[model samples]
Target: MICGVKQPILLVLVHSAPENFEKRKAIRETWGQDQEGVKLLFMLGIANESEVEKTLEEENVQYKDFVQGNFIDTYHNLTYKHVMVLKYAVYHCPEAKFLLKVDDDVFVNMPNLKIFMKLFMAQNSERKKILCSRMCGNPVLREGRWGVEISEYPESMYPNHCSGFAILYPHDTIFALYSEAQKTKYFWIDDVHVSGTLAKKLCVTHIGLEELILSDDEVVEIVDSSFINNTKPFLFGRMNLDVHQIRILWDFVSKYTPKKVILDYLNY
Candidate 1:
């Protein structure tokens, strides 16, 4: 165990947009009373001062940080937002061990995460320095507004996945990412700009994973046992997971008895 317990510090950064609030609540409800030793930091995204207060009143959840300003527009702007948020965590929330950057619509399988980290820690504590996810090489798309020609990089540069939706970064590495960004202009697309482009420029190595915490539109069924058994646990990214997929994954996990999840934010 890293700190008298096996759980790593968990920070679920959710942009508390209209649709995001209910979605995030559902995710927390999924945890119910099962996740222990996980420190949750709900990140609410707001555009104005009033929205922040309104969010606080409506949700009734204490947030670790309230990120303001609209810095992005297109699909790529997310990268900059993510990088800046991570930077906030690094500079502000130093206690967090592992930072999980996820979208409002996404659902994370926490038990699987715990199991994966357990194995990772068992193998090498140094592994915490690198970002881990199922590596999606930059794709070449010709028909969409978001399509881009994949750039060629040395095998060393293309470590694994480039999907920026859901990624896990250790505390130290996140600091490095923010440091790198300060040296350059903020890019609009946060994934390539912050996670891939900026990180690549800094030479921070990324580890390839098998399962992705972020999903595409496709539906995937993940089992609790299978999740723990996964040799290569990945954070799903890129797919637009519909209701069907969510049900599949949720129902599957429901088969297992949930461990007691507690939230002592005030005491925390």
Candidate 2:
């Protein structure tokens, strides 16, 4: 079991590459900081090179929040990474209320996520659901970057699946999905396999599409003061943000002040 947290209400498992040390540091110093009721962990796969492994070891020693799996760290192996997280959660943090799976590049608005969760739970008190932006009607690419073999997936169009960049799962739903994954055929696409195929097989609730707040347009406006005040985003993606961009946006969101604050004080 990965060390450093116990019985947290929310466990954020970030899927990260072995070489993204700066990105990891930015996340840690900003929104990924330790908070009450929340636990943050970075999940990675084994590094191929010795130097990278040494760096990973040092980082793990310092942070004690890195979870490494036995598989190679590659885009196609993301499903393995997801499975490792599920196995770890089931074995170690079965008591956690929710598990949030996000990529290293995504910016999570923890405050907004908390508010969204509270409202979501209040509305659907007894439902176990996975929350993410639903993606459908996408044809399976037969060539280049995201190509898949006919043997891997025979379907021409992908079933409705959450965007793998960020997803929130109820504890029971994760446990059920993980169990189903053990028996199902492996698919290289992590989102479709874990959230779509396995989730469908297990009959878990999936809240998709507009229900999840993942907009690149909104992410572009994250630096706007008014946008920060008016918006409550659960997670932001398609952000190939550098360390500087990460820090800048984090500062804006963390220290935002609504336009009404000054007006209310003046009126008083």
Candidate 3:
């Protein structure tokens, strides 16, 4: 479906935990459909427990859209999953125009994502760029939950980077980042490490997508407004939505936007 009619606009690599089987199925049924220029691939790592592995195998049998890595699936190992995306994208789906790395909890509007890409590509030349809420000058913690040992990163502050919750990576950066991640010392914070440290090492530019992405509060606000106004918000994405919330949001948004996506598809 990628290199066919639409030139493969987006490949979404979703970060998912090993045991979240139902959530994956729900997503596949909802917004994760592989249609148009969008293809969905789930990024998973090895589960610690055999039960979890069994569950994952069962789930994989159902949808079979996984690009799993050998690293253990844990919070501290998110960078492993992050690098897995770069490796897979580099060697496997290199022809895809863009890679959308998103958390499983986030809600993405397919039509709005299409529109966002059209707008992003129109205003900017097709180069190694990221589109997301960019982070800059983040302090390196030493004693907190997300603390990094002096050995991990001796720097006082982090470099400019795109937020990992929902990042859009131009195709050119995939091999560069994969190569960088292999040489760079591993950092547990995937966003700062892969998106910031490795990204800066290769001179990747980022375009701010803050306006298109919604916050947790904004998610509630948008859902409420959609209920009140009988129409959905025209934003690119939402964060921390559960399966039920996503289902409801899709029910409302799908009703309102089928004609719009059809129109946009024709226009593109």
Candidate 4:
């Protein structure tokens, strides 16, 4: 869509608060690339109206910001803001080739991401199909890190659902998912609601999970390396991790280079 590059620009939807504002900004600094065709948009949430102006100035956030509102006030903390996220991505940045909806705490590996873009382009070549990290079936968390028991999906399992932390959807897929959400009033779990249910309606399929693209372990290692050794990491999922845990992980991995560290991680 841009003037030169064939690959569509990647739209990154970010959610940030006063506390993690600097952290997210730092994450962007590590991955900032002013390529001709690609652009990253940060859809931040401002909780306080009075502090909005000050927050923008302090955080260096632009005017293209939205106040987050959801079904439940303070809903699931970050999870509850999913609908607002969908609205912003679909309605606002329609020109993007792919929409990368990520939490403020997560870090993206941009170079590897370009590899993924090439792979997807090779497969469909249409650049229109929806692709998610394929799940075997409906999986549910049971007393695990993200375990939750909801009556709507009481089976305690999900069928081939992508993790909420990182999901990639084609531009057109947004319309299908949003339309289904309007018609169906079901569970509030954002991953299940969009990647599972709405995705089903949109005819979205899960892409194979690869080590580079999405993984829980890599998340920990990156965050760990960042703090312990004063090294910035690639794609650290901050939301799922506790602040103290983040500090600890960064402490452990920061001493090594990302390539050596991640390669070592793969070797083990």
Candidate 5:
């Protein structure tokens, strides 16, 4: 269990590269602070360089919120990273009500997330679902950056899966998927393999991104409007933002009052 947190309502585990000290620092200083009902942890793989490992150890000594796996830190080993998270959660923080998986670069609106969870619990107390940006029929590229061999994924289109950048899962759902993942064949594409294929195999309920909140366009408009009058966004993704940008956005969103107008647009 992370320090200062007993039984967390939500545990956010961020997948980070071992050398991304700056990104981790930015997150802790910005949105990853230790809240009453929330706990924050960063997942990392072994670093090849001695200096990087030394630095990571030092950071862990100070923060004590890092979960490290044995595999080498590489894009292709993300599946291993995901599995490590599930195992860690099941063993270490089983009492947490929800688990949020996110990448290091994504910006999380923590206040909005807490509000969303409160609304969600009011409706469905069971909390047996996965919530994320849904992706359907994504093509399997044979070459380039996201290349995959035919043997890896023979199907032309991927199964319905949530984007791995940011995903929220109930604790029960996480346990179910984690058990299923052990039986499924390992695939290097973390999002497709874990959230898409394995989730399909287990028949986990996936709540689409649109249902949780309005589209990103409306969110941006709201954020760009009168800062004092704007409503908070549930989350913002695919943002390659720097520390300065994160701090600015965090401060801006923290002050915004959530309005019922935005809630009216939500599908569920």
Candidate 6:
């Protein structure tokens, strides 16, 4: 489907599995809500199971927000899914000013994100760089599902890259990154491959928002505050929170932030 119909300011592409129907719903009802300038769409791969595909189609028919890929939906093909979404954004949503790639489990604080983007856009100097929690010299795993064999990646340390938990990309960077991704060999650890290796190859500058990425302590603050006194101070950093937590956070955050388009960042 065509994008920028509303002349979108931000386009959020969620990396979701086809079967995580509830998680997608939680996102839609919470921070992923589309508004005047912000658009949200889910990117997935084809589910091999007929039942799963049928359910996805039903969901798609109702929402009309999915942009799926040809690859089979599996953990090993994340790179394929990642690249596919970038390609979609570049060709389909070229008018979008920003691209946000966040996984389903992450909790995105839209109010704080709006404030950050408001500030971020003013500084043209930082506009081209990737804004996210930067990961530098992360060790490559050699065991389990996330394992990277020496044959696959000979390096002991991953290049300085943005963690896939959440990444906010300038529209232009998406184009540049997508171009490079096409030429690069596929790497299964999509986080490292896309934001780390491909990014390093292009020499992309990453604006570190380490402080904004919430830790367990910050997550606890939300529950401890009973979701009220403390406004969402962090962004895109909740640890694989449950559906209930997402709803609770949304319920309280909605109470504090206005439903109208955010013109003033500080007030929210």
Q: Considering lDDT, where higher is better, how would the candidates rank from best to worst? A: 6, 5, 2, 3, 4, 1
- TM-scores vs. true structure, each candidate: 0.66, 0.88, 0.87, 0.65, 0.89, 0.90
Cα lDDT computed for each candidate against the true fold? 0.52, 0.77, 0.76, 0.55, 0.79, 0.79
Among the numbered candidates, top lDDT falls to 6
Model 1 weakest lDDT span, ten residues long:
259-268
* Better structure of 4 and 5 per TM-score: 5
Model 6: lDDT equals 0.79
Q: Model 1 over residues 150-240: C-alpha lDDT tens digits?
A: 3422223332334555667766677777788888765444565666666777676666543344333223324323342223233342334
- Give the C-alpha lDDT of model 5: 0.79
Q: Which candidate has the highest TM-score of all?
A: 6
As a whole number from 0 to 100, the lDDT of residue 22 in candidate 2 is 93
Per-residue accuracy of model 2 over 1-268 as CA lDDT, tens digit each: 2334564778889999999999999999988998877888999999989999999999999999898998889989999999888888898778777888988887776766665666666566655678777776778998998999999899899876888888888777878888899999999999999988898777766676252343556656764433654434444534566777677667776776333311111100
TM-score of 6: 0.90
- The all-Cα superposition gives candidate 5 an RMSD in Å to the true structure of 2.7
Candidate 2 wrong stretches, greater than 4 Å = 1-7, 209-214, 224-234, 257-268
Q: Deviation in angstroms for 202 in model 5? A: 1.3
Q: Candidate 5 residues 16-67, lDDT tens each? A: 9999999999899889987898888999999989999999999999999899
Model 6, C-alpha of 3: deviation from truth (Å): 1.1
Over the stretch 87-143, how does candidate 6's per-residue lDDT look in tens digits?
888988888878889899888888767776766677555455787777777888899
Clashing pairs in 2: 134-209
Span of 10 residues, lowest total lDDT, candidate 3: 259-268
Against the true structure, candidate 3 reaches a TM-score of 0.87
Q: Relative to the unseen true structure, what is the C-alpha lDDT of residue 10 in candidate 2, on a scale of 0 to 100?
A: 82
